[model samples]
Target: MTGRHAQHGLTLLELLVAFAIMAMSVGMIYRIMGGNARNAGELETRQRAVVLAQSLLALRDTVPEGGLQLSGESGGYRWSIHSALYDTGVAGPSVTPLHELAIVIAWDDGGRRRSLELTTLRPQRKPSPQVRK
Candidate 1:
């Protein structure tokens, strides 16, 4: 019996094509996962910023008069709070003082700047006038 063994196997070109397809699929999956991770991180940062803003607003009295610019880092994020007098209103002179509070929370995301701002109006007690002779 003359040897006539038939070889059944994928050609080199076929194998190359299969590898290319697999590489493309892997690349796509990697990109999708990366995007998901980024979105999750951004969401987390936003939540943290909200909580920080609330706490800051609650403690707004700590800020000195004429407003202030405070900045710091916490939980892998950078934050800033800016307080200024938005308006004294047109109510003329009044015993009770009103202030505009603005809190700005900021952070970095993949070289992009992200921030959240919270603002409100707060009433403050007028300082007691010094007694004169």
Candidate 2:
């Protein structure tokens, strides 16, 4: 072609390469967005588990001095609470008896088992003295 009639457009090969690059870029972006969405869901589930476990632990005062074991399900999640005497390793009678309270939250996520556990120490309440007649 003469210089005066020179083409001002991309060749077929260039267009094909550009389209390929664009396709790959779009695929990568789609994958990133999908992964972000999945992570957000997993995080939400974990946050809910933590909140449930905290709520169960808040009932520590009601636990018996001999310790209590309970389990139940709520909102598609299975939960359990286990309480036992917490030995501080201090010899002799302590001023306040401590108990270890633990809560486990479990659920099914995308065919996988997910669980969270939280533990705390609480003092046992003493029994009231008998009233004199």
List ranges where model 2 is wrong by over 4 Å. Answer: 1-7, 91-94
lDDT of 2 at 45: 94
Backbone clash count for every predicted candidate, in the order shown:
0, 0
- lDDT for 97 (candidate 1): 55
Error of 2 at 15 (Å): 1.3
TM-score of each: 0.56, 0.86
Q: Per-residue lDDT of 37-94 in model 1, one digit per residue for the tens?
A: 9889888879998998888777766435566677777776666776655455555565
lDDT, candidate 2, 1-133, per-residue tens: 6568767999999999999999999999999999999999999999999989888877666556778789999999999988889888765665677888888999999899999988888877776779999
**Which ten contiguous residues of candidate 1 have the minimum total lDDT?**
87-96
lDDT of each: 0.76, 0.87
